[model samples]
Target: MPNKPSLTTPPANDPSLDNLGHPAIPFPSSANPPVQTEPVVEKTAEIMQPASEKLTALRAQAGSKLRSETDQAIRKLGAHSEKLYVSQAKLLDNCHSQLRKQPMIFLGLAVATAVAVSVLLHRQMR
Candidate 1:
């Protein structure tokens, strides 16, 4: 059996490969000065703090707006319901006044309605 060439090793004298036969990527060595991380962390915190505050303020503003709108809607509904109640009371008062003015007429009408309903029920049973 013949030996197969490995896929992991690059070909010799390849232009893309460095003298060490590794890809030509620059890596940090002891020669370069160490990168300072504290400034980056402070800058990130400085950038995020205002954004967090703005988000919290916006949330509170939206909640306040929603509460105010809900209260306004409830007040409007309550006012409409109050109007409906007043109108219903007025209608009942008018009906009572009419019945008082003509008790005998309403009584006759009631008896006729009762007789008509009984006749309908009796016919349905048959």
Candidate 2:
């Protein structure tokens, strides 16, 4: 017959496990350990400072470019509006000249258009 192992005995080789099959908690040996954080923090700050300055400069350059583009667009709109206004004024002048030269023809056409519209409306009502 084979013998059974005793439950009360602990294994000798492994120090990480306790007798109850749970992991052992580690205790710190040194009284005061050094933090050693200042050099890393200073290096990070030194790297980030140049990056931040470049970012600020890039933002300013983009803003100036956008402002110039906006100004150019506004100027183009103003020029187009002026051209439209001048063409409209010329059209109005030509219409006025034609009307002055031949008033009776325009009056007859107007009467004919009114008669045609009224006849269409009367037909629709029926």
Candidate 3:
């Protein structure tokens, strides 16, 4: 008779596939830490304990990471605000310098307008 093709289970002696058909071996169980092996009956509790501990550690790390991110963002905002303030101060300084350089022009225009108004007021009074 010819060998029949199998679908679910591999041949018992097949070197490639385990009984469960999962690539020769199953994934490692957390219960049997590489350091020591637990009895089959104690595997479930051993696996659960490690998973919970890892989760707690991850949570603490996540909190610390979030706090660090917030602090960095605040520092960046403060730096940008300081830069904006400095820019405004520089602009105002430039305006004051230009006004100082052209003082004569402004003074002349002010005196002329004042003199003309005074003359008109005197004529009106008379």
lDDT of 1 by residue, 1-126 (tens): 999987886676576653343446443447645578999999999999999999999999999999999999999999999999999999999999999999999999999999999999999999
* Alpha-carbon lDDT of model 1: 0.88
* Tens digit of per-residue lDDT, candidate 2, span 34-125: 55799999999999999999999999999999999999999999999999999999999999999999999999999999999999999999
TM-score for all models, in order of appearance: 0.59, 0.62, 0.41
Arranged by TM-score, best first: 2, 1, 3
Q: What is the C-alpha lDDT of each candidate?
A: 0.88, 0.86, 0.83
- Cα deviation of 77 in candidate 1 (Å)? 2.0
Query: How good is model 1 by TM-score?
Result: 0.59
Rank the candidate models, highest lDDT first.
1, 2, 3
> RMSD for each model, in Å, please?
6.4, 7.8, 15.1
Q: At residue 65, what lDDT does model 3 achieve? A: 100
Stretches > 4 Å off in candidate 2 = 1-43
On lDDT, the candidate that comes out on top is: 1
Query: Residue 95 CA error for candidate 2 (Å)?
Result: 0.3
